[model samples]
Target: MSGHRKNSSDIHTPDLTSYPPSPSPSSYSSNSSSSKSSSSRNRVKGAARSVAGVFVSCFTPPEEDAHHNSSSAYGGSDAFTSSSDISGASDSTEGRRRGTARGIYATRNDSTHMKEPGSTIFTLAEIQTATKNFSPAFKVGQGGFGTVYKGQLQDGTLVAVKRAKKSMYDKNLGREFLSEVQALSKVEHLNLVKCYGYLQQGDERIIVVEYVANGTLREHLDCFNGNVLSLASRLDIAIDVAHAITYLHTYTDHPIIHRDIKSSNILLTEKLRAKVADFGFARLAADVESGQTHVSTQVKGTAGYLDPEYLKTYQLTEKSDVYSFGILLVELVTGRRPVESKRELDERVTARWAMKKFRDGQAITVLDPKLQESDANGPVLENILELALLCVNGSRKNRPTMRRCVEVLWNIRKEYKDLLA
Candidate 1:
């Protein structure tokens, strides 16, 4: 008899010749003999069929073969097989073979199943329809992330959809999305932007946030020609912004650093109330314990408001927020962009120039001319400017805590009211 040689394509077949057949009985009932022989033939044929079935089922494209056939002993060869080939006369043995084949099929299917991670997945068709096929009329603004569009949901809720650029979908983009969601979801203050939801499909990363119809503080400041906002109004906006920062730094469980604190990130309502927006680079201080914070990663922030210490060390903390907020305060008082004006090279950034004026006991020179229109209480500007100076101090340790800064602004607001009374 030939030695049983199993090939890779014969996984379910056993070498029937290897196992000796049971001895035939000298005499038996005709029905019993016929049934036994019939069962044995079926067992052998079924095993062979199963082997062929398994081989075909397991076959896959070469690229996927590494993943699908990891445990396969055949090693992609057509000539080798496993030890499944065998013949048996018992019905129980035949049943067990079928059960084994079924199990193998189930395992193969389970291994092949691919599940997607949790994210906002919008069909291209759906997004196209939602934005009216990317109509130009709906575009709100172009940003570093991508272009933003104002859209209306079926439920009549207004949404500002930020359609991120394809470049934003890099390897670490998923981490940025998770970071924004985790940080924004925790902060709930009147002066902080509200995140509606997010969507990520293919190369499109969409962030849907509340539509601040009034636009950014930067827009208001720039459009007003230094005459739009009175000193009192500016002071009010400053107080609210300070409160928002304080809430993030001290009130939240883990402090959040708003890495980008430019005027554009400071949104406004129709009533001129300020709300802080954008948290792409925000991180938890607790994560520093795990050596994850900063981690010598590439820097991320706006040009004008970035903390110099953070730029050097990449070690971001709540004090970095204080420094940015100080820059914002100077912008409020002087109505100057953080950068120097080309028309007057002598003028430094509002923060440095104001600090110099404060040191010289000549803060009025740093005050925005528009602020004088309301004859608003000068004492409030003095007190707030003092706090702003403390926040913008070059040494990180000298920056005031957001909580104390909030109290100082509040006290100044009260002082204004008392003086008016």
Candidate 2:
């Protein structure tokens, strides 16, 4: 984490007082009618307000709210809904309803306590018992926050319990844990990790989320030897991730920019469905009506996935996520890590290497050998490679919005599926 931090004084920070405006609606005109576009924007704003309000309430004392009479300082339950039920709604009506519902849920709750409707509050004893007294044997994953253990409740439901590292317990880390819980609890998306509940007892803080059986995309590409991902499978993953980011950026009332978007943070289900995980670095985008283009904040992200422009200017934007997603796209195509120091200097950075090959009319050289073996996937792969190039462009302005990325990736996925059929 220390290495990922940049010194503010050493860099020439941009004048964010009057930041650049978001791309004009004309950029998105090709996809939706103006009326639909306006409607979508309203939904996003409404959702943003809902999330923002919940975040603020997290700082208030729980005792102030009698209805939220839970003993824990920060606790609530998120109602789980079937994915089909949520996704089956007609586009326009559903979009509007989502915005209004989020706003109502946020406001309807007791303001003093951060309450996630439909989420359950787990006792420390319950979590400890589920995780076998925090035994190392049940540990499935470890990250900066803490170790994640595979736990099973009394009802036979599996879950992932993430407990903060003992040494990292402090005001800042506590805030991050609460923020992650608040953020995850507020929104329910199939592509986003589900938070079943949380535990805050004395020195311990733990988050319980749905257990994704398969490992991360990073493991599948770099470590797993069981199966080679086909071009269609890779395209499916790309579309899943694109839709997740699109939901964060456009569908919410307030757009969230996932400051870190890398392969390891992407989890896979048994069916290889991708779910975006780890929201510790997630932040709300600049208020659109404020005429601001980005949020001015300290640079926080992994070295390889960090947005170069963000590093220089310290102005985080949705395009920053786009830049990282571009690197991810390259990884999907080439089966290379975002940054490979062991490789030749010229090919060390995946995005730079892929872009150079694409420009030199040697894009095929960067294609994973396994993918190259499939003649049937060549044309669709070429289209995907082109989209990846556009996403990783040095200039954020040149990068397509997440919505556009979703549209293009979905088209490619459909084509690849047809090819398979």
Candidate 3:
């Protein structure tokens, strides 16, 4: 989180264009008709602009029109990180606090308050009971954001409660907590994790989102529970992720950039469908009407799937997410992590090596060995790898728009199905 720590993958940061040498790395629920209504979008757009503005220290918080909401990240020799594969969050509290806007709009509402649509306001008491007083037994996941516990509400519905740490690491967890609540409150999509409610009372802050019963996409890729992911499943996952991002970029009230996009952030349902999770690090993009190309601001968190251009330039755009998505595409097909120090020196960065093999007319060699290459699957893998190369292109301008990503992925999935048929 301080100075840039160089690694084998670091070599690709300057440029990740197809010529080679560079690298890197949402959901919503809104009603169909109301969301399409021009009047509603105009109303949300005003608030969306404020959220995109910088929240620098000593900078006054903007007035609330009352709405709206709001990556690299690494560690490892085998791309070393914690057991959760979530590290590199250590930082000068002041630097992170520079973007803190805790005084922004609150989503909290007591039982007496009228319930709002799209999102809810939960009470601490209710959350405490839901989590059995934050029982360690209920723990499901943990990261820089905090611990996530599986909670069951009184209504017999299950939820994942992400409680901010009340310790030293939480100096400004409120900002992240609120940032997520704001962003999740705005959009809904099948591939996007839904926001159930939130709590931000006193030092206790939390976000309750849709609980995907199955584990993460990373876990599934690792063959968790002795289950192997097939190319068909992988293709669907790639498409699901693309559609989720497309919704954020083109269909949301505003284009919200998922600054942090990685396999670990992708949760799978019992059906193996992907649901993009974690919006604590999301940045609300300036509406397409603004004509502003990039968000000039602080360096946010990312994972091995980080965008080299965003890292080098400190100017973020939706294309940055596309860069990360490209990294993910490589991960999906190869069953390799972004960094794997255990491999040969040249092979440490999976995206680079995989693309190298593809360019050398050995694209089939890049397939995850778990799914042995076959005649029918070989062409599908090459097309996806080719798309991945385009996505990781060093220049953000060269990366396809998320909508375009969906289009390309849809075609890949279609072709694969045709081959199987």
**lDDT against the true structure, each candidate:** 0.56, 0.64, 0.66
lDDT of 3 by residue, 1-421 (tens): 0012112111221121122211111022223354345554454454333332322231222322221211333221122111111011111111111111211111232222223312456899999999999999999989887899999888767889998787534334555665676677665567888677777666676888777899999999999879999999999999889888866765655568888888999999889889899997777774435446566545565546777666665676777788789889999999999888799988888887887888788998888989977777998998888778767766554555665566667777777788888
- lDDT by residue (122-193, candidate 2, tens digit) is 798899899999899999988878899999988777889999876542444555576676556555566777
lDDT of 3: 0.66
Question: What are the per-residue Cα lDDT tens digits for candidate 1 across 253-353?
Answer: 44567767778898888888998987766665434334342323344666556666655555556666777887788888888887765635446455666
Model 3 per-residue lDDT at 300: 67
Task: Name the candidate that leads on lDDT.
Answer: 3
**Candidate 1 minimal-lDDT segment of 10 residues:** 104-113
Candidate 1 TM-score, true structure as reference: 0.66
Query: Residue 399 in model 1: shift from native, Å?
Result: 1.0
Q: How many backbone clashes does every candidate have?
A: 9, 12, 28
- Give the poorly placed runs of model 3, Cα more than 4 Å off: 1-118, 168-172
**Candidate of highest TM-score:** 3
Q: How well does each candidate superpose onto the true structure, as a TM-score?
A: 0.66, 0.74, 0.76
